[model samples]
Target: MNSKYQDFVPLKAIPFVEFLINEHNFTLKIVHQRETKHGDFRSLPNGKFQITVNNNLNKHQFLLTLIHEIAHHVTHQKFGKAKPHGKEWKTVFQHLMLPFLNPEMYPMEILPYLANYLKNPKASTDSDVKLSLALKGNIAAAGKNFIFAIPQGSLFIFKDIIYQRGAKRRTRYECLNLANKKAYLFHQNVEVASYQREYS
Candidate 1:
């Protein structure tokens, strides 16, 4: 776990996070990416606790996800069966994240957004577009562009589904899924595959 931590977390954050994992006796599993989530925590029937984080996340997101799951574990030990991202979890998550909000643990570019986010962190950091984009280093597949960067009426593919971009409704963009012809809201930072073609 010590060596694995080096690969997944920022250099300055390794020691503190290692302390939390060892103190809790958790089994941290770096698994393949799951589109719907960055990480999760669960208790085994055999009395073991495991936290799984996607292996593909960048170091900043990886550290955030690790602490996020650790907060879940700590919350469970204290609150027992509470709402997954309810007040209890939020409080625990905020407290656990406070220490890592520093320049040493995070980059200057990401720190401000992170500090503001931890004030009332959501179930996913992707909820904050500025923060999410910063975590991504504003980089995507060379030719791909963020959903927001494309014009309305343009076509884009996400998760293999083709969506036609629509108007901005408050924080998210409204998009029509070409397959089902149903509307779905997309985060501005969502990177959609770009290509040129004619579609009816």
Candidate 2:
């Protein structure tokens, strides 16, 4: 195991971590939670390549995020700053994920969904509700209610704003914020607290 990544990746993920480091020559770092992204890769102005993954992810999520970022690094090396999630990146991402698409690397529940997801990869795992939900099942429940748990037309609070859940549009739920009366798309697996209805 590389001493540098020993602290960031779990024991079960060491092999994959080593593969990325040795094969791609990337410097990996696991940092605190990043709100907008699970992981990212960049080439330093000094020419050093680095990848950073959020430390809060579970082992399975960590591995997936790491491989996703590694795919970006690989794509950048081959194509030189093409679209971030373009065809080249998707192809490389699926290729890197092929070896780990099994019960050993991921839970059986998530494996199938993950395999399907790789066929036409998206920008993020969160964008795939089935796969994201299956992955979330592997970790301890956060005790927060999921957006999918709320009935359609039911009001809920997300990020401190009140919204009414609407019809499902593929993997996301369409919602209307009460404050702004504007429609928004939310991930199906987003954790939200339910609001109690008040009777007049």
TM-score of every model versus the real structure: 0.93, 0.85
Residue 27 error, candidate 2, Å: 1.9
Query: What shift in Å separates residue 129 of candidate 2 from its native position after superposition?
Result: 1.0
TM-score of 2: 0.85
RMSD of each: 2.3, 3.3
Put down candidate 2 lDDT per residue, 60-80, tens digits, no spaces.
788889999999999999999
Total clashes for model 1: 0
- Local accuracy by lDDT, each model: 0.90, 0.83
Worst 10 residues of 1 by lDDT: 191-200
Q: Candidate 1 lDDT (Cα, whole model)?
A: 0.90
Q: What's the CA RMSD of model 2 in angstroms?
A: 3.3
Compose the digit string of candidate 1's lDDT tens values, residues 1-200.
Answer: 35668989988888888899999898999999998999999999999999999999989999999999999999999999999989999999998887898899899999999988888889999899999998988887466899989999988888877888999999999999989999999989888886463222
* Strongest candidate by lDDT: 1
C-alpha lDDT of residue 51 in model 1: 99
Clashes of each: 0, 0
